[model samples]
Every structure is written in C-alpha cells, then in structure tokens.
Target: MNSPHNPLDADTLRRLQEDVIDSYDEELELEVDDRILDGPAGLSDEARESRRVYFRELFRLQGELVKGGAIKRITQRLNPRVCRVAALPAPNDREKTQWYFQRFVSHLPAAGEIVLFDRSWYNRAGVERVMGFCSDEDLEEFFRSVPEFEKMLVRSGIRVIKYWFSISDEEQSARFLARINDPLKQWKLSPMDLESRRRWEDYTRAKEVMLERTHIPEAPWWVVQAVDKKRARLNCMHHLLAQFDYHEVEHQPVHLPPRERHEDYIRNPVPADMFVPDIY
Candidate 1:
C-alpha cells in the first residue's frame, strides 16, 4: 500500500539519525559515573579503553557545541532595528467592515525600518480560504489585488521579500506530536491549528493557488525547506541577507565619561520587606 506521506529522503534520514544519536549520547554523558569509568566487575581491557575514548570524544564535541555560541554573537553584530509583529488575529466585526489591505498598511515598515509580520495579508489566501472566514468573492478580490499591491510597494522603494516555509506532512505531524507532548509548547496549538491539521490537503491546495496568483516580479516568493529547523533558519537568514548590498556602518568612537562623586550624595537602603526572595 502506498503511504500517504512522502518517503523520507536520504539526507533527512541521515539528519534524523544524527539527532537520535546526539540525544542518546547526551543521556549517556549525563548518566556516566566513577563505577562506569572504573570498568566495574572485570570488564575487558579493550572494552574499558574504548569506553574512555568514546567519552573523551563526546566531551570534546560537547565543548565545541558550547563554543558554538560564538556564531550567535557574530550574527548579533548584523542586527538591524527589527519590529516583529505577531500573526494577525481573526478579524473582528469592525475589521470585517474595513478593506482587508487597510489593516496591513499600519504594520508596514517606515523608510529605514524593518517590519516582520509573522503572518501577513496572505491569511486571505490560506487560512481564510480554508476555514471559510472570507467569502469566495473576497478571496478572489485578494488574489486579483495582491500582485498590484506588492508592485505598488516595490515602486515606493520598499523591498518586499516573501518566504514560504515548506515542510513535509510527516515532519509537520512529528512537530505537532512534539508540541502536544511538551508542556511549554502546548499553548502553541490553538483550536484553529488543530482544525488546520485536519484540513492539511485543503490548505496545501490553497497555498498552491496563492503562489500561482500572487508570485510577481516585484515580490517573488522564496520557498524554504523547513523540515530541518536549524537548516531552514540558516538558509532563510542567508537568503534574506543576500537581498541587498548592505554593509556595516562606520561609527564615531564612543568615550565613557567618568562618574562624578558629590559629597552630599548618599545612597538609601531598601526596606527588607521590599526585597523579593532569592529563590535561585
């Protein structure tokens, strides 16, 4: 019988295997103790030597992972002022009365600013279409208007970059399962998210139609293979950075002035009741 999900590619399988191995290695590292190292109950000399080498390599690799924080520090140097807006909420009665594009206008970036819309006007093409939040006429209007809307933005000197994160059905299921099992992530699964999972094919079809209609020269859509989260983030960041010829700005050197101590200046003590317990 043919499987509903696509078969895992060799690359994906390798990644998964690596993830599993890492997880198991971490657990083993945590559980290691003096007894295990001492080769308890007459372990072979060769076996003991192999165990020592394995742990030595594992600890060395773990140290490298800790040092990987340097990559994050380097990326921080490229940080532009970013305004991240959460996904647009379901339209209220007032919003329904207004033109769909009107709400998005307020969230648009200023000349030198960058605004990231977690979910944008594409909701009309995806969720709104699949969930019947908008009528067929409304959806058609969005499809007709979006290309021109984007063209207008480009003409106004706003660089519009669009990304569609593509994940396989099987990978999505695994993610949903992980969220369900994880207490911290349970809040991410909304009723709409659950419903969308049920209508995956419908959403997929809507996405295809959206891409076909709205893909324009002014703002072409870039699809990111998102089944591997780390790779997806790195690829997305790399592609986004390549969009413009941005260079680091030269800044005047900053000098810190020494603090002046005034004879009359006195520090006040806080009341004991005002302090919170230092639980940590």
Candidate 2:
C-alpha cells in the first residue's frame, strides 16, 4: 500500500507548531480566571481553598481539551461538505411583521446537502419566549407549528438532526465569568446573554417545554451534557456521524504535473516601495 502524503514542508511544519502553541495559549487565557487565581477579597479560608481546587480541576480539564492540531487534522481528514447558517434572532421589524418559519425556508439545504443551523426557528421556543420578545399567543402557535414544520421537511426528503447542549447553572456562571474576565472572549458575552443568565429558571422551563412538545419521531432532540466542552464536542460529533450510514468514497490518485519552462519568459521584480513593512 502507498504511504499517506506528508503535506507539511519544513516551513508549513514550523507554522503548524506555532499554531498549536497559539491554540494552547488561547485556551489557557480563557481558563485562567483572575478571581480564582488571585483569591478574591472577603472570601473565607475554606472558600479560598475550594476556589483553588476548582481552578486546579479546571486547568486539568482545559489541558485535556486543548489537543494541538487535532481539530485541523480531523477537518482535513473527515472533511464532510456542509453549509452552516447562523439563524440568529430576527430584527425588531422582522420580529414584529415577518412569520418566523418563512425566513428559514430559504436556508433549507438542497438535495444531498447538509445544512447545520447555529440556531434555528426554535428561537421562539427558547430565547424569544423566555425574554418576552414573543407574545404568549405567538409562543403557543410556535409550539403547535414546529413539529409539523419539521415533519414536512422530513417528508420532503430533508433529514433533520437537532442537538441541545445542556450546561449546568454553575458551569454557565463560571463560563460567563471567564468570558467577562478574558478580553479576547468578552465579545461573546452580550446584554442578552447576561439577561439569559438572570432568567435561567425561565429559560430552563422553556427548554423543558420545547423538548416535551417538539421531540418528534422524525427529528428527535439529542441533549449533549456540555459542561465539559471537549467531551460534549466529541459526543456530538460521534452522535451526528452515527445518524447517517456514511462511507468514504473511492477517488483516483492525484499526480502533480511538472511546470514547463519557457526560456523567452522573464519574471518582473516587484517594486520595493510596493511591499508592506514586515513588522513581525
């Protein structure tokens, strides 16, 4: 059997090493919480000790999570063709006037294509309902309509897979705190996220209702225990793969063609003034 291709040249290998270090550094930056590391003011001795233990475990978990080049390797090897859409909350005008399901129809994948929604029409069932963005009647209608809408999609030869990442309140709080503390991650926290944190119970109740109401045979909701970020990602990927009986397609081996040189052809040198200063 032919050996697999080593695509990385010396320069590429060096860049890959730098990328791995960068990834580890980013993970470390997020996991290092100042409150826990510095020992927060006015904390009891027992609380300080608890915080230290928590930080240690958190660091260990994060270490396990940050696998250098794992994501890049996986994506390169198992490069499944997929279209991703961020189905965020509708604008104020659309929320007031547009039908919720109408907007999603355009985003439906073509035949043999997989479209992964970052969020979906289920916004009405979760955030919109909990945040009072949708009226009670509108929320009730959404609960009534969604199962049928999904059923229709399934009937139309579209396979629907749904996942709900379940995180504990404590874990979420810690994540929020981490994001707030880390400048790089602070952008992830929105006013809506803070409000969601305050109305956690409401969101929980909404989730329960959504699952109970919309868990259909065609597209059942799969809940991933997402407190452990690494585990949740792995489990979700595994489960998603298991949903389809997919196999690798055989392909003809590729051969690189040699470039023909022309003696008459001469390359022009780029002007030194046109080059940007290499600050790095």
* Best model number under TM-score: 1
Q: Report the C-alpha lDDT of model 1 over 43-73, residue by residue, as the tens digit.
A: 4677457556655544443333223201231
> Among all windows of ten consecutive residues in candidate 1, which has the lowest summed lDDT?
65-74
The residue ranges of model 1 lying beyond 4 angstroms of the native Cα positions read 1-83
State each candidate's clash count. 0, 0
Point to the candidate with the largest lDDT.
Answer: 1
Give residue 97's lDDT in candidate 1 (0 to 100).
Answer: 95
What is candidate 2's lDDT per residue for 1-280, written digit by digit as tens? 1124533345544433333433453454455543345343655678557546544544443333222111221232222554344445565775568777887788798876656676788888998898888899999999888989999999999999888989999778756655654466679899999999999999999999999999999999999898755456556655666676655555689999999999999999999999999999
Clashes of 2: 0
lDDT of each: 0.69, 0.67
CA shift at 273, candidate 2, in angstroms?
1.5
lDDT of 1 at 142: 90
In the order shown, the candidates' Cα RMSDs to the true structure are: 10.1, 14.4
